[model samples]
Target: MPAFTDIMSDAFDYFRAYALRALCKARAMPRGRIKHLQLVVGRIYNLLKKEAAYAPNTQQLQDFRAAQQLEAALDRRRDDGSAPERGFAAARPGAEREAR
Candidate 1:
């Protein structure tokens, strides 16, 4: 059988949801641990995108309301489901060196 390229199952949705929950709660974790959890959440995001399992309005990175208070503790708090702005300009190619 061909490997499943796309699927929208309750299990996958639950995993994605809980993973975001975990990420929201990971603010209190150690730096390394938080990074690891973020990595896992990122992978889930990529896989879900590959599956095209997301609906029109649902956010992939946070709970429905996205009112998690732990965000207040972050120096770079992000409320949207978009990628966490971990570092400015780091994602852009040669951005750091270009500034010099």
Candidate 2:
């Protein structure tokens, strides 16, 4: 059987990927959906933090910090109405004018 730390490390990696996908999805999501994703990211950040406390390794600490940053960025985007603009910025240069 794997060690407890190994199990935790695997779980951490899984949640980290999950959080990344959620963050990307949040960028294009509506405000209400972004709000829900923010809560989910917050939960994942808390989980990473707790794991860091138990493991105290460099990689774990870095992941915890990244999760913290991701949550903060999501909060900022949600509050500042930037999420909607992400889609606009990704459009072709003349797409906005053409749509108008």
Candidate 3:
């Protein structure tokens, strides 16, 4: 079986992707605001940190770093517009077009 750390990491990764999708496609309500996205990212970041504290190897550490960087960029998008492209780039993965 996969290590517990691996499992948690995968779960967080999926949730991060889902949150980004919601941010990108959110309409006039709950998901459209940067504040909402920021909140989600904050929670995810905390969870990621807790998992990384017990990360079994370097690979997991690297993955956590990448996720943290993305989370920071998302936070910046909530603050300033300089990272919009990166934020949107991260906000959507695996597609050239965003969902409507």
Q: Pick the candidate with the highest lDDT.
A: 2
**How many clashing pairs does model 3 include?**
0
TM-score of 3: 0.33
TM-scores, in order shown? 0.28, 0.41, 0.33
Least accurate stretch of 10 residues (summed lDDT) in model 1? 64-73
Model 2 lDDT at residue 2: 84
Ranking of all candidate structures by their lDDT, best first? 2, 3, 1
lDDT of 3 by residue, 1-100 (tens): 8886665655456545645554453333344445565555556555544565445456645665665676677656656865343344435574655554
Q: Choose the strongest candidate by TM-score.
A: 2
In candidate 1, which residue ranges exceed 4 Å CA deviation?
A: 1-8, 45-100
Lowest lDDT block of 10, candidate 2? 82-91
For model 2, how does the per-residue alpha-carbon lDDT over 20-42 read when each residue is reduced to its tens digit?
66666666666675667676775
lDDT, candidate 1, 1-100, per-residue tens: 5556454556466556655665665644545534564545545544554443545335633532232223332324334424543445465888788778
Ordered by TM-score, highest first, the candidates read 2, 3, 1
List all candidate RMSDs to the true structure.
Answer: 13.7, 8.0, 12.5
Q: What's the CA error at residue 79 for candidate 3, in Å?
A: 0.9
